[model samples]
Target: MKMMKNFRNEDGFSLIELLFSITVLSVGLLGIASTIPFGYKAIEQSAKRSTAASLLNEGLEKLKGYQYINLIESNFPDEVYGDIPDFPDFARTYEIRMASDVYSSPIPELKMVTITVFWRVSATNEQRIFAVTYIGQRR
Candidate 1:
């Protein structure tokens, strides 16, 4: 009978308990809110990297379409800075050099082609990606 009377009198949580719960919840929400910006930054960086890689691959593919004899530095000289067709923030450049210059044992018909893609992620941050391939006579 005595235990039942005590249980009936304690109908709801005390003021201190309610305050503690509110404080814990607020801290947890603040922690989650603090991480959102970092998550957005990471996703943005990944997207930029993907775009740079695609640009590098596109440049390399175009070079591969040229004839082996035509793969000379005269045809595709090193570019200083060139903008992407539709991507305003990104730029691309390429260099075509003799394989002999880069490799110790190089074939006479081999030419080294390098494609580079670059972009600025922020005022102080820059990102770049590149691809290299050796082209030789088709025969």
Candidate 2:
């Protein structure tokens, strides 16, 4: 009982301490917020790239349905400034050429096919992705 009479207790934070904590918290929040725009931009670019890759695959699949002899440069359709029906922001094209033109030695039985997808990120920024494959005549 004698010790209790001399005890003084201080609990909870002072105003100055509270203010300092709040300032630190606010700075942390602002630092996290600043990166949000860059994250969004990266997500957008990834989505666009995915779309372009899908278009390239679509072109290749279409080619697979044709006869080997029909895989000629003139046989495949090429689009210029042509927007896909579902993806108007993107345009696609493909080229077919003799494989012999690419290889050092003649390979008359093979044809080289290239598919390209194009889009614009900004008025001054244009982007494209392409894939190549070779089709050979069956023995």
TM-scores, all models, native as reference: 0.84, 0.84
The digit string of per-residue lDDT tens for model 1 on 36-67 reads: 99999999999989988887788888886788
Q: Report clash pairs, candidate 2.
A: none
Model 1 residue pairs with clashes = none
Model 2 per-residue lDDT tens digits across residues 1-139: 8667555354678889999999999999999999999999999999999988998899999998999878876776666555477787888887888888878646677888889999879888879999999888888
lDDT, candidates in the order shown:
0.80, 0.85
Off by over 4 Å in 2: 1-9
